[model samples]
Target: MARLKIADNLDGEPQTAEELAVKTHTNAPLLFRLLRALAGLGLVRADEEKRFHLTPLGRTMRTKGDGAFGDFMEMFLGDQFLPWTKYVDAIRTGKTQFDQLYGVPYYEHLKKNPDERGRFVNGLKQMTKIFNANITDYYDFTPFKHIVDIAGSDGTFLINILKNVPHARGTVFDEEPSIEAAKKNVLDYPNVKDRLDFVAGSFFTDPIPAGGDCYTMKSALDFEDELAIQILKNIRNKMKSGTKFLVIQTVVPDTDEFHIGKLFDQYLFMLTGGKERTKAEAEHVLRGTGFELNRIIPTTYPLWDILEATAV
Candidate 1:
């Protein structure tokens, strides 16, 4: 599905199986079978000439320029796809097979491989593009003087927020490589540039940067439970008792009807050894870390929930 979607965008038309196979570097026969299956599912349609075209669903996967589609495909298909062979073993051992397959943990693998790191970062940016607007809409930023985005990669989300809230200053804290990218991104906005500071260090080891009235962590808690708590605790320790902490992440719905959260939970579990939490689960985590859940703000869009909490 991903390959066909990308190829359809690249070629600007529905391509035949031969064209798809050559573009995707797969066998033509297998490509034909896959396309046929997709057509049957109404994802794509085949013309009388046997050329395939994207259905409405298929067009949703198409991307413009160097967009989410390519980055998302690279992250899932190229890097994370290999570890699925060991899923049965992972289930048996109750451990991630990614470590066994790559001989390192997921984050470690990303740190060591620049190409993979680039792809992962780009994919994250793509994801942020989808969610940043929702975040800007559903949350209130008027009360904040300065906002610190913890674990903020490339500052894309912060940039969007800062662009809208003129009086609100921004700070982005992340690893050195990501901070460097954020610096480049902030160059255009001189007004926000003076207000924006890019700090490089592990949030676990370093003091959370001060001077921000509000702090945010986007989809960051799911990365590691202990680390996430520690970050919240660290932020709580520095806050003046009124600082607001916003956690923007997918709030897993309790029901089992197919939703993006369900799929993302499995993806996190399989690839990153992380798990998405429900609203109650989030409340538990926040309360355990010396904060109280203010509310779980649902967006007009899907798969995103804003958990607003404050230090006790």
Candidate 2:
């Protein structure tokens, strides 16, 4: 389905089977057979002249190059697909198969390979838009004077919030690479220039800046549990007793449904050696880290749930 999506642009020009096969690196006959199946499923359509075009479902999958579906598929089919063959071994061993399949851990692989890191970051940017609208709308930023966005990449989410809430100031804290990228993103927002500050350092190693009423981690805690806890504890140590800790993450649904959040959980396991937690699991982690879970606010979108906590 994704291959067909890449083949058919929004202009509705149908690529030949050979062209699609070359693009997807599949055999021509196999690609045509798959397209036939998709046509039967109403995912693709064949005109009277036998040219393939997108059905409504297929069109949705194409997503104008910046869609969440494209990002999701890219991450799924890119580097993460290799570890699924050893998933049973991982389950039996209770260890990540990614390290076994590849020569190194997933994060190590990402750091060593710039191409994979670029793909990962691009996918993250695409996926962030899925929940950004809800994040900007559901949370009340007016009350907070200064917000420190820990591990905030490119400052897209913070910039969106700063634009909406006129009184709120923001500080984007991330690694040097992300901070460099964020500088470019913040150039147009000169009105918020005084309020926006970029700090580049590891949240686990460096001290979180004081004087912020609200501290946020946007999809940042899903990496390593101990590291995540250490970062949270560091922030808690710096913050006042009543400071609000906003964790913007995808809350895993209880059922085994095919939610995007569940798929993202699988990606996390395959790529970062992390797991997306349920609301109960999130509360457990927070409590273990000396934070009191306040509320799990459901966003307007299904992919995200805002878990608000406070230092105990």
Candidate 3:
């Protein structure tokens, strides 16, 4: 539906499959079958006249909306979905199948393919909007005056944080692709426009911007311990002692009580040869990189949390 733009064409008003087929440019017979399937899933309902209307649930598939999941569905089930075919091979070789198939890491793949990159970044923005909505409420940011979001993509999370922290300014540290995207994203938030800055560089090679009392990395340290430690140490060397370091990502539960991170860990491995860590695993990496893990602050969202730390 997303690929054909069928969902976006649907309004609450009833329309027959032939009408939808005209808009979406698909065969009327095939469209009717799909519409019937959608109705089975409660995304739409057909009347006696065989005209279908989008249910509230179906409207979430629209490309443009406040709570739309169209991009999320498109990316996860579209671009990212292809890598799953290599899952068994990946497990056998302990490698990212995406890298094997595409001849580069997922991030590198994004750099090579502009169209896919655009979709991936937009999908991430949409996903962040959904998951990181309550992060500011869960963690206090008023005390920190300046925050530097390391490897912050498009600055969506930083912008969300700065919107809540009126007194705090922030800088988003990322590569050129993300910095370019962040430049455009920052324009949407006029209130925090003056306070946010985007710095383009790699945390592994470039000198991190100094003087921020707080630094944050949301889902940025999912790489192997050595690589994650290198990035963390780079930040540690640049920032002063006692500066707060917030690692805002999921820590796999020690117990077997189900959590999304358990499954997402495999996805991370597929994309970057990285895996989600348990609390102990996270602390081991942090401690090795000259930071002390203070506590894990839970957000309302199950998969998100703040791993509060201090540069020692």
Candidates' C-alpha lDDT: 0.78, 0.76, 0.86
Give a tens-digit lDDT track for model 3, residues 151-258: 898888899889999889999999998998889989999999999988999988799999999999987568877789888888999988899999988889889898
Worst 10 residues of 3 by lDDT: 71-80
lDDT of 1 by residue, 1-312 (tens): 654454454345777888777777788888889889978987788999889887666554554443335456656766788888888887888777788888888888988899888878876776667678556687879778899999888888888788779888888999999999999988887767877888887776687888788899887568668767877777777677778888888888798777788778877877878888988888888899888899888876565678888878
Give candidate 2's TM-score: 0.85
Alpha-carbon deviation at 91 in model 3, angstroms? 2.0
TM-score of 3: 0.93
For model 3, the stretches where C-alpha displacement exceeds 4 angstroms are: none
TM-score of each: 0.85, 0.85, 0.93
The number of the candidate with the highest TM-score is 3
Instruction: Report RMSD for candidate 2.
Output: 3.1
Backbone clashes per model, in order?
A: 0, 0, 0
Over 183-281, each residue of candidate 2 has an lDDT whose tens digit, in order, gives 998888887767799999878789887888998987756866876777777778888878899998888879877778888777677665787888788
* Prediction RMSDs, each to the true structure: 3.0, 3.1, 1.8
What is the Å distance of residue 23 in model 3 from its true position?
2.0
Worst 10 residues of 2 by lDDT: 2-11
Pairs in steric clash, model 1: none
Candidate 2, 249: how far from true, in Å?
A: 1.7
